[model samples]
Target: MSQLDPYGNQTPNRAPDSWVPDPWLDQPDREPAGEWPTRNGRADEPYTGSGDLPYSEAEAQTAAYPQVQPRAEADAEPATDPVRPRRPGPGKRRATGRAGRNLPAAIGVGVTLGAVVIASLFVWRPAFLAVIVVALGVAIWEMSRAVRAVGAHPPAVPLAAGGLVTIGMAWYAGEDALMLGFLVTLLATLVWRLADGLSGFGRDAAAATLIAVYVPFLGGFAALLAEPDDGARRVIVTLAAVVLSDTGGYVAGVFFGKRPMAPTISPKKSWEGLAGSLVATAVGSAILLYLLLDVEPWWGAVFGLALSIASVLGDLAESMLKRDLGIKDMSNLLPGHGGLMDRLDSILFALPTAYLLLAVFT
Candidate 1:
């Protein structure tokens, strides 16, 4: 049956399966989408998308019409609209943690570093001392950069040289030599700062002093651990406690962290994580002390608890420093760890705790 279109033209008779022009895609001046040829070779009426019809109603009319299959386009790959990267639809989005932190790589590097350090400790005292010197150099370098953020420029050369001397003396000469090295580093830093002509001399000198004490003086305590008969065992216990504390905190925080331990300085740190760290370190320290060093389990337990606290303190201290300086990680040297200083932050405090424990126990 012939029917009248909106334009009042008689529509041609056609088969039920014959395709019609889609009005939805048609333009005012151009033909409608997909017009078919009539039986006598004239084109069927083009659907005009114009008119006062509602957009939804026009879409409904288009749906009622079927599109004709063209031979050329048929052989072509289905024209898939480009898969654009999707912006998430409106609603609350998923929460994301610290991005790009490669935990597995960090763990692997930590294990490898620990193995190397333990090996060096037993292989030769000088080798271990060298290792300490190298580590101190890296840490001091990182700190030197950190202080600059606050407009303080410490003397790097004097500080690094003094750090090496401090680490060496702690192992070879004793605590007294280590102290002397620290004092000399301070004097040298002050003298070096004087050359810059008093603009920020006080700030620079003070920062240098901090660098001297923080990197080498405090770190020198690790060398003293080697002074005892089973120094390597003591070193191992110290490291194990700190490492266990960190690992426990991370694992627990991931699974069960609720309350933030420090909201401003380190937002991710949680009380639950700290508790996990303490418990794990306590147990681990006791085992290492009793089995490895053959020390009394009670003493091991005390050392564990103490070192765990020390480790947390060290981590917090570093976080505070970073927050003050407005920096995230110390550097990008280590993939998961951030930088050398990041890894050393907790151990710096743990070293002194180990030395104290050794002094008391021995």
Candidate 2:
């Protein structure tokens, strides 16, 4: 009996079910009090460890789990796979193509503008002048920005101010009034630049004066057309002829444009395109005179030749400005057309030529 009950041969201190008792509460009298606490649903098993937070089996199990990283962050890091170097290529650009990426939008805007101008011409004529004046103001603003890129800070405010006055004078008082107003605007522009002191006065004043005269002064001719008899018809015919010329030029240039016309100024422009334009202009002028304005076809031919030559000069003038400033377009506002400056280039010269021809004929 003493051999079996020896102190060295003690049995494992466990429950009758072979569950090893917690080593913490080693007293033989104390059983696991909250070990199987399912019925009461609350285990108030006080942690006897040196921690402020009470130990919970559920919390401990949750904290013990391994954490997984998100794929988004993993992907954001530099890729591990071998990368093939990109070959040397063309310079990065926001847009490309001859016409434009947003051609539909461009066409829609152009159509809308044409509709608005025609509606204004007969219904409320002064509104047409107002629209033109506003457009000139925007052009003045764009010109200032372009010149600024080339280190000239022109006073756009005075220039815009003068443009509005010049347009208004041309509409009410005629060509003489337009000239007087333009002179006043240039004087005002020069005076306005005085406020800027001696710094860049010459360049700024000159630029402001130019902006006022070039856009608004030349544009005043179109307003003068509104003063003559059947003015709306005259303006419409002029617009139609110019538009036809531009269209013909574009069509010819695209298909049969092998040789450049003035490669130094505009590489895309071709002599073939100019020839097409002259043909279209001649036809359009005859129709405008005989059917629309009741003028002789011979006179129309003369007008076509003069206006076509002027139109080429007009386009080249704008291109020269762009080339000098080292810019491709004045603005990206007109989508496929470029900017207001680009659209008005041909029309600016055409309007003046038409006015001069009309004065001679009358």
Candidate 3:
């Protein structure tokens, strides 16, 4: 016998025990007809076995309805749509912290720099001055470019020329000449920016003056340190103490840093790392001062403590400046170290501090 289905198509009626399997039913991947909308706009109810159906109720349900998934399996499925964005896997994201840097390259560059500095200090003091001049020039150039990125047009020519004069005067002439060089530089900067019209003259002149003071003016103290007898030892002690602070901070920060020092400006710095720097710098400076300069251990500790704090301040200050300027590094001139300014920042801040303390105590 043949009967009409809900869709008005003919459906065969056979003995329940002798019915053959439908082709659609054999393919479990396809949705069953009962799930489709009917003429009344409702999904057809589960097939419990209609009056004219040839199959038993269990067979009807099994062949015409989807099976209920287990509770665990259903819960295990993803809640979000497959098309939505997901968190990047490890391979997709940047590696951070110590693991992210090229440690070997950084170490190599550091060692090479240290060797050059030590040799310059020992060979001839004036040679060291030349090195400082070259470094300050690069640092000034970097600072000029960085400030210019933010619409400030610091005159690099005057800044560099004045820096050479300032540093050379501090070395050969004295403190008075250093002051004169700085004043002249500031004047030149003001005059140079005036040539560009008064549009941003003050802003441009201010930036150039800051570069002069921040880089060459402070750096002149290094030349002063080299002027005294046993000057090389003093310079070495200062450089060594700062290096020890940085090294200790890096090591401790990588292993044990928990709380951020300044999350907004410098996310990587930590109070614990600062403590490490202080302790290491204090001990290292004390030993160097006592053995080399014949200074009392206590005074050396004081000097070290002061320099460590100054270095920290310098680091944070540069971090704030970079954040304001929207830059990661001043430049990528140095493969692992970022730029001359990045490496010089701490040293520049520490230089005057070291010089004054040594003069007072020794």
Candidate 4:
């Protein structure tokens, strides 16, 4: 057998003809056991001889084992690792698919129910109007709540007094009496504002008073629709025209709306919808007049056109009020809809116009 030299070279003293060099030790530049080159070139190899270097028994054991790479370094190897999955954010969970469908369904149901109730009031006049009166009062309270929410301090005394007076005059008095009551309420609002030392008193008072009259006072005409003779028919026909107009506008707007009708006031409205509303109202009113009132188709067309235009203005007026107050809806009293004020907003102008027309022509 051949003996190996310190550098693993074959020695001639022992069986040099039969010597077999170890493959690992045969490489001259390769590091030996317990030996590694120093990074700073201070030491070429680790000293394993007795007392040749300061090292503990554990360090000696570690030196005998192979060094392992850190987990971070191992993980960075692209072939051995899979990509991490991304986590979802908070907003991702709040996405809803039913909002669009649900909103329209809610509005449709609410309007149908409201129309049914209004029609019933025509059958049971006293009881129905009483309910409407109570509803109006509640609506006023809701408006007051909304006003306060936007940081406006309204005079409660004048608001309540004006609301009651308006309701009373509407119930018992004629048109002149109703107008006089409105004037009195306006004066009361001003006085109350002055007593409270509130700034923007004029504007606030005017707004509050108008809200009462616009919501309930105009609603009083629904009661007058039940008068004997053809009065009820005329009122019902007018209401039918308004309803048809609204339905036409909503359907057309959804399908063919292109140009905005009133972008600043109502962003969703379209000229297409407005035109549809006018045509539908005119046609519907003509049919009602021919069938119910024995009136000429031309007269019906004129009334319908006028009422449809008025309804658009009514809608815009309410939009302006809501925009000024920084509110989207008046109240959430009605499911999927808003408060009585919201439902009655379009009817407000329509009712008064119908009443005036009837007073003059009928």
Candidate 5:
């Protein structure tokens, strides 16, 4: 055997298995109190060095190349799938659909009912007048309902009295009767308010009183138009003027309109439409004058211009009311149209003006 190193390793001249004792281990007389190094060159104790401990073989392998998680399994829904079916182009009709599907059948019913009423008016004038009175009464009621819908407590008795007085004035008396009836209605409204202890009658009473005059009183002019002594012809002519004007305005505005007529109240109405309405009304009035009345062409032109302007004012008034009430339409009574109020608003003012003109001239 040859000599060896102080450690467990053999010297160059020693055999491979010949071991030597360590110098530190040979010092058995000293106390074992100090820290020692671990196999990876780190201190064995917890508070030894700043370096982190060596990882295990498994951890090192994992750190070398991380295992990526497979993508989550896709859902079975077609819309959510990665390879969804392509949508059809806008030009293509993927499914067959029914025409006239959205049209209201109620409009057809209303038209039929209106025809029956018109027929009854021609056949039996008395019965027609009575039905018209009732219709006006119902319209008054609806006006009251509208007032209430806007959170106002209208004086019901005064409103009903006003409506009745207006109807009576239309039936028996002339313009004098209308003035007297208005005076009586106003006096009665005040009296009724006092009788009710002035409890809830506030601005609502004032508004309701105004509505009574505006809706029923003005609307009663239609009855006056249907009276005898050329009243029927005048009424028909007036209606034709209003209708033709409205139609011409709507069509022209949609096609060639650029400037707004009343941007504050009715943004859709246009100056171009107003001009078209005047032109159409002039033409319609001339035709009616030649056919029905022996009036000059100038007279027809004058009437057309006046009636068109009045109709526009009436429409704007109604639009202002609706804007105040924060509503788009009065009701869904007419499909692709609006309510009776919407249709009759212009006619209401136009009829009375035409009647007065006929009374003066004809």
Candidate 6:
């Protein structure tokens, strides 16, 4: 019940609120209208009591607000409240395991491919050669597309044609013809790049030659394996050994692979997985060779060990290539498996190794 200050707040010696009526409501007289007061007779400058304010520059800046820091209790909520569950990753539901692949699709595709290989291989020799041709063609096409990213325009047509000739020579003609055909293909690839002009001739020719060697040259050994009367069995044993190695590695990598083998190249690969591959390959090779080729079981072990090491190297080499090319997969043609090249990576290395081993053992 006191009179107020200018802002309508009660002061120590003020009269009661009832005694002091509102000035704006009670007063009748008004001052004559005039221009508003300004600092230094300039409207831009706001008035300060003493001349120009010393902190005018600082005052011109917007007021800094203190950031609202998060509460410690909120961060500690997850630890204390056992009922609140953490969110899972996006792929956790669909992925089969830590590898993050659709396991069902991968297995189905693998079985189908294996069945096709066996059917063609045993049914007719020409049919198996046709299969090889088709696989190499697709691989070359994929590489052609992949290399374009690096400005290397490998001629896919000549590459495919040369691959056909190479595989045909290896299967029908003999080992000498195989060498002759490879040299011819290499020369053909060099000449093929000439049509594209000399802009990137060296680069393009190099890539094309690499494709020729990697795809068909290595694949010719498979044809070599199938040349003998008992050739089909030899090829089968080689395929089984490589497949077992991959399977054993995959299983072991999933369960016991804590230490990475080549983390920079393939993060999923581990030393423990490699151990599994060697054991599986060796054991499987021994059984298959003894049963099919009438060879000693120990020879099979030697063959398996060699093929396993080569297969791992092949896998790592392709991984390095893909990493260099800045691609995850050569193509998405094969769901769950990635590309034909991906499937053939280990096979390419294993084929030559198997051929060499069989030549020595048998």
Please report how far candidate 6 places residue 153 from its true position, in Å.
0.7
Displacement of the residue 140 alpha carbon in candidate 1, Å:
0.9
Question: Going through the candidates in order, what is the number of backbone clashes in each?
Answer: 0, 0, 0, 0, 0, 1
lDDT of 6 by residue, 1-362 (tens): 45566677766765564366555456544333344343454434333333454344435552465545479855564555457776787855554756676877888888999898899888887799888888888998999999888888988888889888999999998788888888888888888779678998988988988898889899889899999999889889998988989988988988899999999999999999999999999999999999999999999899999999999999999999999889988998887888999999999999989998899999
lDDT of each: 0.84, 0.79, 0.85, 0.71, 0.70, 0.85
TM-score for all predictions? Answer: 0.74, 0.72, 0.74, 0.70, 0.68, 0.75
**Best-first order by TM-score:** 6, 1, 3, 2, 4, 5
Model 3, position 100: C-alpha lDDT score: 60
lDDT of 2: 0.79
Let me know the TM-score candidate 5 reaches against the reference structure.
0.68
Q: Arrange candidates by lDDT, highest first: which order?
A: 6, 3, 1, 2, 4, 5
Structure candidate 1, residue pairs in collision: none
- Model 3, span 1-362: residue lDDT tens: 77654456776874456645554444345357676545445454344333333234445677788888899988796687568778998766643446365566677788998888889989876889898899999999999999977899888888899888899999988777888888898888788878889998878977887898899898998898988889899899999988988988988898889999999989989988999999999999999999999999999998899999989888888989999999989999886779889888899999999988998988
* Deviation of model 3 at 66, angstroms: 24
**Residue-level lDDT tens digits of model 2 in 1-362:** 12212234546553456545444444344337757344346555545443334436656766899866688876697768878987657743334335444556667777988898899898998788877887888788788888887788877777888788889999999978999999988887788778879899988877787687679988888899877768888788778778878877888888888889999998889999998888888888887877777889988877777788888888999999899999988898876667888878888889999998977865
Per residue, candidate 5 scores C-alpha lDDT tens digits across 119-165 of 75567666656665666665566666666656776666676767777
The segments of candidate 2 whose C-alpha lies over 4 angstroms from its true place after superposition are 1-101
Better of 2 and 5 by TM-score: 2
Distance from true location, Cα of 103 in model 3, Å:
1.2
lDDT, model 1 = 0.84
Clashing pairs in 4: none
lDDT of 1 by residue, 1-362 (tens): 67665566877784546646557544446545355434344445443445554445555688899877798887789868898887887764443335347757776888889988988988876678778888889999999998899999998988898788878887888889989988988898789779879898888888998888789999999889877778888888889999899888888888999999999988889999999998899888888899988888888888889998999999999999999999989998887778899999999999988898868875
- Which residue pairs clash in candidate 2? none
